[model samples]
Target chain A: MLCFINGEIKNINEGSIGLKDLALQRGYGVFDYARTFNRKLFHFEDHLERFRRSAKELRLDLNYTNAQITENAETLLKGSDLKNPALRLILTGGYIYSPSGNFNPNFIMIAEELPTYPEENYTHGVKLLTYEYQRELPHVKSINYLNDIRLDPLRREKNVFDILYYFQNGITECPRNNFFVFINDVLITPKDFLLHGVTRKVVLEMANKYWKVEERKLELAELNSADEAFITSTTKSIMPVTVIDDKKIGNGTVGMKTQKLIKLFNDYVLQFSR
Target chain B: MLCFINGEIKNINEGSIGLKDLALQRGYGVFDYARTFNRKLFHFEDHLERFRRSAKELRLDLNYTNAQITENAETLLKGSDLKNPALRLILTGGYIYSPSGNFNPNFIMIAEELPTYPEENYTHGVKLLTYEYQRELPHVKSINYLNDIRLDPLRREKNVFDILYYFQNGITECPRNNFFVFINDVLITPKDFLLHGVTRKVVLEMANKYWKVEERKLELAELNSADEAFITSTTKSIMPVTVIDDKKIGNGTVGMKTQKLIKLFNDYVLQFSR
Candidate 1:
């Protein structure tokens, strides 16, 4: 594996950070994940935009600009044997905290083999467990995932793919995916209360051209009446949610809308991969 | 400075973690801060207990046993020239994430100079700004401080010492301190909606011996009628809040109860330091 640490390329085994990095000390950092298809990045600009936004939100200084990050990533990928790679860009609060002092941000980019999902997961869909919680900062993509990581045991025991978070009355996003449902032919998902996912934006934009897309509060009650449900993420693209908390969603099979969206997403990716 | 990374002691400048350390990658880690008084750690057991509890809450494996951690801290302190140092014990999720795979947790202990607060901060007390925000997984002492760091500008502009967090109905806690209010001669602090700080536990236990202590819900309205309010933490100990949101807290000076509690705390620390 190849990685970029502070503008220098190194083997994954050699990629290390100082103990005083604020990301390790106080979880003060922002990161964005992007994936490559056939050696080309999909929605690279979108990911960079979100990365910059998340960094700004956390008040973390990005020592390198977006162009520099992209250029470095491209250089790393070009020197690697990866065809379909997963890349993570991290900007940390830096090594050591001086009382009311300037910080030197740590910039790291890691490229790894794309995670391979079983074909059954996309075909038969996946189960989800409901968790009652909200992220600290919904808009910013910080490195904090204690809530998500802590639920791994329960998630594995229940044989679920991810945990869908809900705050009291409304359903928020999943651990790493954005929730969407087709309620009475109008595609609906929670807005403002969740991280705006890159793939979710793509699906929403493409879906908006064909279907009525509403970005608003999605009540938990509405899930029971949904015609179909699915989740969008950088890795999964659009994954159908067949079972949610023991309740079968839309006859427990992948819905037509979900299939259609997946097809559209695949087409979009393929068209841009070249 | 000397520090413990994993099981090895290294110079602070040479202490480093892999880029894949979950603490850096996902901010999935728990930490506890303890301060030394005259080179003797105060409430060392309490801090360790909390550290273990937090690691348990996060399911982070401490490859080293509690005894090992204690021994390492003692060795690090003995070898260092730090007097009245601030020590932090961190247990990260691991170096990588795998599906249904065990992770090798990264254990780190860092010792640094103790922060010095102005005498006026403890004598006249400090001002506070109120923000409506609640921490996620408040019981666990994770490195997630996004909300607190995000409020840095507001805190600096107002020249306030800290930001007190409140939910819809009542005050929860300050950014890094536990909130306490003396209402009608009874000392009250939020029971379960915040992290139970070591110093807070000490103060509560000591205060219970002298005054009425109620560990229950404290309504936002009670702040206005309260005789006094203060915040507690390992570093700050019992710091009184003179002004909260521009409103004077008990005549805009350190209340007698706060001063009394501070004196009790100082005496207790002095007794244990030797």
Candidate 2:
């Protein structure tokens, strides 16, 4: 895997900070990410749109317009080697101030090969223990992944794939992926309680054409008895969750409904590669 | 300002990232910052302490240790020809994993100079409003700050310096700084509910010697009637807030208690440069 940090390919050994920098000192920074297929990015516009929105919310001086970012990204990809890679942009809160007033903004970019993913798990099906917590920000992806990381050690030790973070009230999501439930004939997904995933948007598009999709604040009553359940993300695509907490999701198998939606989404995304 | 990206003093204009880059796409990145006073860094060890904690929490791999980071940052600073710059170090969660599961940790570092303080903000003191939201990772400083940016437009339009976040029962710190209250001879500050600021720590050190210092959870009631109120961070050492939510802070002229602490802190830090 190769990484271009501030426009350079370098050894990971020499590219890091001392313990005391301010971003670490106070958690002051903003970032965004998107991946590519066959070395070509899909929905680059959408990713950047969210990125710009994130920067604005965090007060990061990205100093690049969407068009300019698109141009640069396209040019950079023209010379890359990997068949598939993931990219991320980072902007730090200006260097350490007296921890005082107006401070200079610090910026950097790291372009690297796509990080690892559990490809097999998506296909074979995964179990989700109902996690006990509320999604802090159901609307945005911020860098504070502590909640996610907190469970990593426990999950690894237990050999589980992921956890379904549902509100005690039965609302689900606010985890690594957005969630949906297919009950009877309706494709019901948690809305307003999860990040409006880019992939979720595409899934909605697929559902609009072939299924009765409904976006509503979901409740536990609806999910527990649902005929099917699934999760969506840039990498996960549309994978079925065989179980949530301990209850079997639609006979503990990838429901036919989920597979169809995945097929539709994959086909739509591949159109970009062509 | 001088910036050392992978130990090079390159102009920021020369820096750019490929769109398909992993850092940009995954948001797998980390960074740290410190300040220079009379051409030297202050509390450098403390910054590194937090930096390491953040990296550990995020599972980011640094190419080097504390000594090496310091050396690289210094070399970059000297090479870039900047003095009294707010020094920086940024590291991205490198493209360590191939999209197909192959692994290569690609990470990089950049050290640069930025303003330590904005004269206008420090001298005149700007208006401040409470942000409805707070930092995502109340602990580790990951490179995610969109919430701050999203609230900025509303803040700037409303003529506020920074938003002070108050949860259901208590007052959190400013979106950018730790909040403090000075009453008669007792120094009351928000504890556990805000970022444990290095500047706030310094304030505590001084208060221990000059006044009564209480480090515990502070109620909103304590802030409203305080004799003096100020904010602290790595940059804004100690800034008096004359007004909050349309109310005055003490006499609102940088109370003697607040002023004394700021002076004491500066006098303690200036020793590093000499």
Candidate 3:
């Protein structure tokens, strides 16, 4: 595995950050994850745009331009032999004792084999545990995952795929994925307090052509009336949700509409990659 | 400066963590800080007890026992030439790709010169800008400071000492300190949704003997009826707060009770260190 750190290419194992780095010191950092399809980065620009927004929101200065970052990522990918490569771009508030001090930002790009979910996660669908959590500064994809990582044991113990966070009875999102549900022939996803994932954006664009899409607050009680529910992310693209907190969603099976959306998303990705 | 990383002593500059460290990857880590007075750690046991609790709450395994960590910190301090030494102990979930896998925890101790606050921060008191925000998992001292660090520029621009976080009209705490107010001659501090700072505990114990101490929800509106206000932390002990959001607290000057509490806290530290 190879990674680019501070403009230098190095083996992934050799990539290290000092203790003084604010990413390590105060968990002050932002990151974006994207995957490549057929060795071509998918929706790289969209991911970069969001990454830039996250950095700007956190007040982190990115020394490299979008083109430079893309070039560095492409160089690392070309240098690797990964079949399904995933790129993780991390920009950290660099070494400084005081927050107001002038400090350089540490930019890192890691290339790793993209993870493949079990086929049953899509065929038989997966379950999710509902948690009442509202991420701080939810719009920015910061490095803070304390709530997600700490609740992982409970997630594994319950045999759920991931935790779905709801705040004030409104379904927000999963730990790393944006959630969408179909109710009364309408597709809906929460509009506030969540990372707008690239795959989610694609699905919205595709689904809008076939079905009515509403980007608004989806309540927890609304899940009971939902005909189908699914989540989207870079890795888990349009994965179905059969059960949530032991209650079966849409008769404990993947809905026909969700399956169609998955196909549509796949076709859209194929066209984009070409 | 000297530091300890997983039982090995190294220069502070050489203390580097891999990119895969959960502290960097997901910002999954717990930390506790304590300072030494006259070359000896003050209330070391109390800080260690809190640190252990924080690690347990976060489900992070501490590879070393209390005595071992204390001894390691002492060793690092002894090797350092800092006059007023402060120790930072960090326990991070070590390198692992998946959250379910077993990970080796990284225990780190860094010795640095203790920061000295301006004398006016206590004598004439300091101002705080109130912000409507809440910390995630406020009980455990996790490394996630995204909210605090991001708001640093705002704090600087406002020329305030720190941001006072209030959620649901109740004053929670400062970014790094526990908040207290002497309202109508009775001392009050919010008991929920904030870190149980060690200095706060010491102050509560000492103030109980001299004043009426109530650990309950301190409403933001109650600040108007307050006679005096102060904040407590390991680094900033009994620092008075005379103004909050441009509103003068108790005539916008350090009150007599706050001055007495500061002297009492100083005497307590001196006795503890001896």
Question: What overall lDDT goes with each candidate model?
Answer: 0.86, 0.65, 0.90
Off by over 4 Å in 1: A96-101
Over the stretch B89-194, how does candidate 3's per-residue lDDT look in tens digits?
8989888646686767798899989988998798899999999999999999999988888788998999999999999999899889999999888999999999
Report the lDDT of model 1 for residue A272. Answer: 88
DockQ of 2: 0.11
Model 3 regions lying over 4 Å from their true place: none
Best by lDDT: 3
Clashing pairs in 1: A143-B26
Poorest lDDT segment (10 consecutive residues) of candidate 2 chain A? A12-21
Error of 3 at A209 (Å): 1.2
What TM-score would every model get versus the actual structure?
Answer: 0.96, 0.74, 0.97
- Rate residue B170 of model 3 by lDDT: 90
Candidate with top DockQ is 3
Between candidates 1 and 2, name the one with more favorable TM-score: 1
Per-residue accuracy of model 1 over A121-148 as CA lDDT, tens digit each: 8899989888888888888898888778
Tell me the spans in candidate 2 whose CA falls farther than 4 Å from its real position: A1-124, A132-155, A167-176, A198-213, A220-222, A259-274, B6-22, B77-80, B98-126, B270-272
**Tens-place lDDT digits, model 2, residues A1-274:** 3333444544433344332333433345556667788777777778777766765655555776777666656554555565566666556554444322443444444445664557766576777766666655555455555466456665666556677776656666746788888988889887765677788888888798777999987877676778888888776777778876667888988888888887777787788777
